[model samples]
Target: MNTESLLRDLREELDDGGLRGSFLVRDLHTGQEIGLDADLEFPSASLVKVPLAAATLERIRRGELDGATQLEVEPGRVTTAGPAGLARFRHPARVAIDDLLYLSVAVSDGTAADALFELTPPAEVTRMLREWGIDGVSVRHATAELADTPAERFEPGEVHLAHALAIRAGTAGRGHPVSQLDVSRASAGSARAYVALLEALWRPSEVDAEVAARTRDLMAHNLLRQRLTPDFGSDATKWSSKTGTLLNLRHEVGVAEHADGQVFAVAALTESRVPAAIQPEAEILMARVARTMRDHLRSR
Candidate 1:
């Protein structure tokens, strides 16, 4: 495949839509790769949970944590970002660590993700990535911090649209007083770095084989496919990914496997020009880019 021309075409496609972003797609089995702005760091949004899940699973393997361990779902941990899994509960409910991992990664459940942060702090997650030789990635704050970041300096409450519009306009999260949308202030990683981590998750080396297997399984079961799944999802092709959403940003990293034994790891992270508080175009563009990369990789 002519990767250079593919990227040029992709740039045109994105320009037509008035979208800006980064992407990295690798044919894991062949080591062929292609991307545009793959090195640029973007706000992690919910993508940080993928590494958090890997760390937690590895700790369980080392006897540092237990998958079967149960913890209560306190109301303070809940957030409106994800499904009503734990948030719908009327009373404090005890949930297993295993379930928490599923909720955090598969469902992008902020409450469950924040709960796991108490066990494996951001610092520990960072250490795990470095120890595994993953670079160009930074895991800094908890999902709760991401939730409460807006309230830190500017507030009235979570003004999701107002903040999103400001951030999309590149005025909210830039310098001086950091906003939640700031890439530097938030958990962030490049598309290349994420593809590297996905490589590890699929074929284990630093982490235990069993742990990696389980981690991949959980990620494969990610319930929300609206980001990457809609493009490559089919009976012959399997698309599994973790999605990250905050204001105008929509990101997802996952592996797509064809029935013929060819596998590709792709990370598409995009920030839209659409100013709407709820921009479906951003989400659609993410899938469109993934499909473009997938088609290019498969053609080879």
Candidate 2:
């Protein structure tokens, strides 16, 4: 694959659409790679949950955390949006830690993520990744604190659309016209950094093998596959990944293993100039770009 030429083409295409993004694709087994703005940092949205879950599972493996521990539902922990699990709870309830982990990653449940974050703070997760040699990745806060703006914060009483709109209105500190914070202060990582982490998850050397496998298992069940799944061609392509979404940013990073055992780690992180919270075109562009990259790598 002519990675250099491909990236140049991608840059021009994205620029034509007023979209800016970062990409890093590496053949895990061969180590051949390609990237575009791969070193630039972007918000880690729900993608941060991957490492958060990984760190939590590692602690459980080391006996620092007990998966069987039960946690009580508090008012602040319930997120305004997301799937069943913590967000759907109507009353005070106790949930097992293992279930919380599943909800956090599998379903991108914000409430469940906050619960895990309480057990494994962002700093600990960041340190764990760095220790494993995954550099340029920084997890600074829980999903709850990533908002950096009052309107963007998960207020249990507030409507989800309003919360999202506030973020789109740029109520926070500094950002492009679309959102207050296009990038997250809570968690930030470059595409290359995420590719490194995905490589470790695919073939564990620095991290615990069992824990890494468990993390990959959880990510493989990721409910949000609309972004990059279509490009992988068929169900035969195994994509174990994590996705991140904010007001204007959309990202997915994971390893795609073909039927022949060929493996590639792909990170597609993008920011749209459109101000609307819902931009279906951005999502489509992501899938198209990923498909183009995947085909380039596979044909090689």
Which stretch of 10 consecutive residues in model 2 shows the poorest summed lDDT? 171-180
Model 1 scores worst on lDDT over the 10 consecutive residues at 171-180
lDDT of 2 by residue, 91-173 (tens): 77788898888988988877789888888878889999988888877888777554444434444555345435533554343
Expressed as tens digits, the lDDT of each residue in 77-151 for candidate 1 is: 333443446644557778999999998888787778878999999889989999998876778888766555443
> For each candidate, C-alpha RMSD in Å?
3.0, 4.0
Q: List the residue pairs that clash in candidate 2.
A: none
Residue pairs whose backbone atoms clash in candidate 1: none
Q: What is the lDDT of residue 212 in candidate 1?
A: 83
lDDT for each of the candidates?
A: 0.79, 0.77
Clashes of each: 0, 0
